[model samples]
Target: MKKILSVTGALLLSASSYAADLTIYTYDSFVSEWGPGPKLEKAFEAQCQCDMVFIAVDDGVSILNRLRIEKTKTKADVILGIDDALIEVARGEELVQPHGVTVTGLKQELNWSDADFIPFDYGYFSFIYDSQKITTPPTSLKALIESDAPVIYQDPRTSTPGQGLMLWVKRVYGDQSDTAWEQLAKHTVTVTKGWWEAYSMFLKGDADYVLSYNTSPAYHVVTENKTQYKAAEFSEGHVAQIEVAAITQASKNTPLAKAFLTFLISPEAQTIIATNNWMLPVVDGLTLPAVFAELITPKRIGFTPKEVAEQRQFWVREWRSAATR
Candidate 1:
């Protein structure tokens, strides 16, 4: 039973690696200079006496797409960056294998239990607003969608946040979601291709709200020392996107891959991920910056991977038909 300290000396895992080369598939930004890739790669190499190669793809979904194309012929030993929403699709496609790690030291709120995928970092999808401009943010997801306040969000076709908003709407609105999308389109400033474009528009005061993460404010607070940006805390629980990793079926170095997975949840790596990725750690009790403590610790809500995988296309089509009308 590995409990997050407020106790002592918990979360212990043996680091074991083989001499074989291991290739990991992940998103582009994840392997960027500022991202956690270099640090994580160095740390793992120190413990695991093996060559760990990181293969880059466009985004989380792209990794799955590459797997779909390559299957057993793929060169990847481990795959990372596919979030909880896509895990079921990946599993259904048989792109990943079970890591067989005994899960412990996870935040209880996550309520996580999966044999194939290992959660690394997570963030709640949220609507961001500048406190300097809007004093009263919408109190809940329902209010935000219903109100005429100008809002900007991403397109579900290209952006993770866009897909997250789709899930949030479905989770909260259910059968009435079609009507909600129609309502949202009324005051929507514009839907951009990605999170950055929508956020850039919001920063220019083009809109009152932009779809983003609860951790968005922390970056402003910590880096710029400007705290006007804030994530709205909706009475309806927010949808979360948890980035996860799994062993590929083509992996020749299973032991090394599993070791790398275990290392990801370790305190050392969690600390790196939280700060660098601008997301919360999957495990508990890692020391993060003061701004992290200030971020909203909202109640988690939304569908499972299986639910999202099954209904994603349906919801995307739903958004496409109704969002601009």
Candidate 2:
């Protein structure tokens, strides 16, 4: 009897070890301890009864490049943390398939009609400042450019928020974007590779302001109980970023990948994403924490994915030339 029981236990352990893995590719910040990845993973695994694996890349753009490089050999069942800015690129590469889930009543600032990618969370890009440090924050892009206030931002080539800022400036200035960058370059203290490093520098008083989300102050208010941090409202209106997720066309686990996408929009997973990811939930009828209620809702401005894809390179080049000069 003892020998039989030992053999049965071994088989059980082997089966457990061989459970299917649902691999998700996302940005590095999404998987961090402070981000929504772990909690969402745990909740998803409970229902999936499979191993939930996350592969972190540097940013949304990197996620797209990596998927293209891997092609049909990709291990990614689903790709998360991609913002609306790159949706056209993903579609152009044919990296993702239609989710086939009928979504309705999304309460996001932007109307999402893409059948391939599903919106998970969204926010408006804005400059965050410490009230004690800068009493009068710039109310417009032109004002920020002309001000002597020290500012730190991320690079568009490497960061989503950085790309958003570039887009924001372009949208606000139009043909004069180069002129805007030339003036703004005077106040730029340093350009980091990613959002975390830049935001960290801002928190450490490395600069007077940092490019971040309008909802950023909610995290400090809810988690740290610090009310001094605030996102500045701009007259030019802020750029909206709608973060999304989709199943890769090459996913072997089609049903499982679809199931994970379904779970992503569920209330339980959304709540974790909203509070932890520091962004607004996409679904309707979900109550946010009181701290989130205190956040400033900016006038949102954005471009279609196709428009962004076409103009991004040109804007980046113009920005680079002006900033370097």
Candidate 3:
């Protein structure tokens, strides 16, 4: 009887080990303790009855590159944290499978028809500054370029916010993007590899301003009860960044992955993502805290995926040349 009991325990252990484990590749910030990752993990695990593992990379662009390197052998069942700026590149690589979920109740401002990726949360790219430090914040990109205020930004090669700023400049200046970059380069104290590094530097008083999202101020307002930080709205209009998640083509657990994707836009998940990630929730009816409601929502500048795909390389090259000069 003792031998039988031991064998039974071993069999149970083996069965548990063989159970499906869904792996998701996401940005490092999303998985941090204060981010929505922990809460989402707990909520999903309770419903799915399966193991959920999150593998974090540097940023959204890095997530795509890593998936490309692994190709079909990628262990990522789902890729999260990709914004609209990089979605064209991801679709070009054909790294994702169609989500096939009938999405609805998205905010009227966002119109998403893509069947492959589901919108999770979104925010408008803006420059953030401490009101006390910057008594007169630049109201336009031209004003910012002309000012002597020190600024720090991320590199577009590795960061989504960096790419958004690049596109923002291009959208504002058009053929004179090079000129804009040259002026911006003058005030730029330094350019880091990702958003967190640049924002950290700004918070540490390394620079007068940092490139970040309009919703970023909400985090400080709600979490720390500090209201000095504010997003500067430029006359050129802010770039809208719609973040998305999708199941990878290489996923072994497609059903579970699909279920997770569906859950992402659900009211429960959106509430956690909006409050913790400090972004606007895609779905409606989720009650936002007072701080979020007080955040600025700027007029958006629209760009198509085709236009972004066609011009991204040229814009980056132009930006690099101007910045270096």
Worst 10 residues of 3 by lDDT: 1-10
lDDT of each: 0.84, 0.84, 0.85
Taking the tens digit of each residue's C-alpha lDDT, what string does model 3 give over 14-91?
334435998999988899999999999998776666898999987887898899889899999999998888787888
The Cα error of candidate 2 at residue 114, in Å, is 1.4
Model 2 C-alpha lDDT per residue in residues 244-271, reported as the tens digit of each score = 9998989887677766776677777788
Report the C-alpha displacement of residue 284, candidate 3, in angstroms. 1.2
TM-score of each: 0.86, 0.91, 0.93
In model 1, pairs of residues that clash are none
**Ranked by TM-score, top first:** 3, 2, 1
* lDDT digits (tens) for residues 1-325 of candidate 1: 2432211222123334257787999876678787789899898787676677999865666677788899999999999888889888888988889988766889897789999998999999989898988999988988988899999998776667788889999999999899999999999999887666677788888999999899989878876899899999999899999989999988988877887887788788888888777889988767788999889978888998778999998999999999867
Q: Candidate 3, which segments miss by more than 4 Å at Cα?
A: 1-18
Displacement of residue 185 (Cα, Å) in model 2 is: 1.8
How much lDDT does candidate 3 score? 0.85
